[model samples]
Target: MTTFTVPPVLEARAPAEARGVARDGVRLMVSRGTAVSHHRFTDLPGLLDPGDLLVVNNSATLPAAIETIDGVRVHVSTEQPDGTWLVEPRDFDAARPGLRLRVPSGSLTLLRPFTSRLWVAAADVPGGRVEYLTRHGRPIRYSYTDRDWPISTYQNAYATVPGSAEMPSAGRPLTGAVLSALAGRGVLVAPLTLHTGVASAEVDEPPYPEWFRVPSSTASLIGHVRRSGGRVIAVGTTVVRALETGTPEGWTDVVIGPDHPIRYVDGLLTGLHEPRASHLKMLTAVAGEEALRASYESALRERYLWHEFGDVHLLLR
Candidate 1:
């Protein structure tokens, strides 16, 4: 796996707005092959050709982090077909089967381990999970973040479907103005839904399955773009997964890496991933290992920020 040590100071502690930068003013690192260039995110529309298509994720961020009455932090990942929720209890050392944590309108009972870190638990949340979360949950935060941020700070401006535990952050920097510019520049844009699970993958672990939908309209548009010799640029890793999977609606567990064949996507716009993150493997599959490594080195040397609220990277063919 391609890896590098990210300095602690490079971690973004807050949203760009809180750091005195406009949401669209965050730094953007563009890599075409092995050459790297720096620019603000607002410059995005001009970076691509007129016929290029930008595919974005419309899955919204959820206030998935809730504190139990006993003060245990639980991150709600996904709800299974059987109606049980997959969750992560942060620092709750005594976590075990039958342990129940009380929430505002619900109680979570640990049933078994879903993964090494996640638990498949039965949650009794009244009035639906979205309604319950809106009233009682906060956005998930890690040790790197300084404090809690509002749900708005964790959402893409165009998100309409509420399901993801964390933000599909690559699209976060595309403000209303940038969208307009892309349209004016004659760049086509489309949306797909991919409700992301908690981004708490253990080192070298593959991403867990999450619900996704590639609308027939979007899939047809992709075929149209490819036939016209236009590039299909996925706005985030979620979009890549959904577009490549070609599934109309269902759970996806596909993992793209260096050896994986790239069929639908020709470019990618995304955030800087942590060292050894499986996301990096998708980056490699899209941009090649040499380009991926050189881009990360440039990002680190230039001191660009990291994490969901930080700078963005554009990898193109």
Candidate 2:
């Protein structure tokens, strides 16, 4: 058995805040079948065919981390079918089914435990989810982050739906100029919605159910692209989850691994992820195990960055 490991030096600590280098100035690692190459993100427009379709996640990031009177930080994962929210209790209190946290902007009450660290709860905010989060919430941060960044810093260039707790970070480096460049080359871009949940789980833990929607138009486009010999390039893993097994609108618990063969996605444009992370399993499905191993080894040897705010990797088969 092989164990994947991400070294400590590769963890990206903060968003790109450098001058003279646009956020997209990060390096790009491209793997085509068994061949690997390196380039800058600005060169992405020249890498693919004009007929290729770039499927993007239009879901935006939300300010989901909040604190309470008792100082327990609540991380909102997503909304449930019952109109309540799924959240994680940062600092465990003696909270039970009826426990309520009186926040600065509103009140959040625990309904039950969804998981060991998560709770199903309701919010009685002054206005609504958006307004409440706007007034009191901050972007969810892991221990790797130095400080809280503004919600805008976590947003994608083409974000339209405000639902995801975290950013669909693969598209973060895509500015309007890059989009125009791709368009000028006859490449097409389409949108879908996948509201990503919390990432506080262990790396190999199977992902929880997440809401996704693939419109009829996008579905038809995918079919046409396949028939016309064009590739379907997913911008992020969230997009891969949505387009692969998603219906018009529903929840997805689909976990792509090396054992499962991919059907629709041809190339993947994504941020460098942690080693041994569940996402690597999906990458193995796209690139064979040996090829994936080679790409990561090359990335490590070349000192490419890692994490949501790090460099990008393009796996094209």
Candidate 3:
């Protein structure tokens, strides 16, 4: 009963990289346990107190999808403990081991299947993976995304470490200006690295184990702020997972839901998740079933948009 219907038109058609909207001009929906409110993304600084800390994911988005020699496009999802990668190949006719898939600048060999659509592959980038992908790859986009956008648009302003197959989109609205304003207001902002894997935004299954790192510095800051009675807000679910798991650095497949209570994070800043998506379960853990249902109803009634380039939701409980 907590999940509500979302209109198709509510889906985000494209990121600003493919179009001409101010990248950070999206709307924001703010919610407490009992009621919901609406505001522009610019008002984020005013919503918090001086001691509040906003944690964001610094994992940069990758131009992970590439067209191979045989007209098959592969989306590199995750880098495994070994040098090989987990990839999703589209329109691939012959999917078998030792198939040398060539990119514009390099090549890859499909080793075997990791999952249904995902394959384990060995990459051969002459100029290095990052450089080659920068030249030949495009950001992995879903069907709802009408056209291709530059990989730059998929990255957060604070992005540094290049790893994520997709964007940690919840932090997209936290523009440098917004961050600067928060700093001026004495609200602390911290960073964690949670390299997200490829997801279609509608995935119902639990997320795969993605690499994440919560450095000692970030952990210490979080502890200090919490001990001082300050609110610790995670800017995205990725950050929430990284913090709750509390690993110095490791892979996490932790799936949080209503049955699983989240600790450490006080509130959340996230994109409007679709109903039945696994992300909604994470939101349910934060806002509870009844409150989340009401929030969804309010969002649909107000015509708030969804997806990476659309509006955001601020959950304060």
Candidate 4:
């Protein structure tokens, strides 16, 4: 393992609107060894050498937002494969206690206090249609914008497998032309799945459990990249999780930070996280504290936006 250093804080001072479409259109900051440069998202293909491998997370985002019986808004941000939910209600009335939600196929009652923002519920999805109904319920959206959330807005063109309560986000900037351009340049592309749960608000509770998978093919490809001395560029933190978790003997407890050592990925492309977000800790683990802090401070000074629909940062080693 490499010796890690703590970096300075990167502030996000950019307005939300500036960072919005930039999700697919933001600037990309790339670092190779000690070299750094700035470029548009369209320039991704030019940054990679022929043997570099781009690892993408194909987990689909779930429409986890739903309305309760009393019209109280509740966001089911994380869904367990076992049919339970990790819920966060907007201004939940403790006196009212339980919440009843409607899904496209059936309804579910959320039992309170599983944790601060977690709830227990039971629902039957014949042939596993939970994802389908969640989509039908409503498009999962962030509270930052007032626009009616569109499913297409939350998805990257390459997204597959419906499971995340929120967008994986890291790949949001990967447009079709960018992908084709990479292919034309001989950069290898691969996929994995790390269904992200609902993003806990900066003021919401801690992270809830989410499901993920690293296909045998993906694992093999990563190994091949490492053996050939080719960089494994993970598209987002979710991809980092999937790759790190897939390591021969590694496990995470949902906490982010420098204490964790990522074993599989060599480079990262991700969004600008809010100050104090647990996600920042994950970035620290991958980029080391010093580089992360420097990048963050630069982003803040550059006024990068924070959240899912925001600008991105790339760190390569």
Best by the lDDT measure: 1
Output the better candidate (1/2) by lDDT. 1
Clashing pairs in 3: none
lDDT of 1 by residue, 177-280 (tens): 99999999999999999998888542667898889999989899999999999999999999888877767899998898888898999999999998868899
Clashing pairs in 2: none
Question: Could you give the candidate ranking by lDDT, starting with the highest?
Answer: 1, 2, 3, 4
**Which ranges in model 1 have alpha carbons more than 4 Å from their true place?**
none
Candidate 3 lDDT tens digits, 1-317: 45466788888898743456566677888889959998888888998999999999999988988897768888888888887888888876688899888878677889998776778989887765566667788888778888777777788899999988889999997888999999999999989899988874356657878899997888999999999999999999999888888578899978888888788998999998877688888888988888888888888899988988888999987
Ranking by TM-score: 1, 2, 3, 4
Clashes of each: 0, 0, 0, 12
TM-score for every candidate vs. truth? 0.98, 0.93, 0.93, 0.83
- Prediction 4 TM-score vs. true: 0.83
Q: Which structure is stronger by lDDT: 2 or 3? A: 2
Q: All models: lDDT? A: 0.91, 0.85, 0.85, 0.68
Residues forming the 10-long window of minimal summed lDDT in candidate 4:
1-10
Candidate 2 at 76: error in angstroms?
Answer: 0.4
On TM-score, the candidate that comes out on top is: 1
Model 1 residue 227 CA deviation in Å: 0.6
Q: Per-residue lDDT for 21-76 in model 4, tens only?
A: 44446777765543456778888898888888999988777666777556667666
Q: Identify the superior model by lDDT, candidate 3 or candidate 4.
A: 3
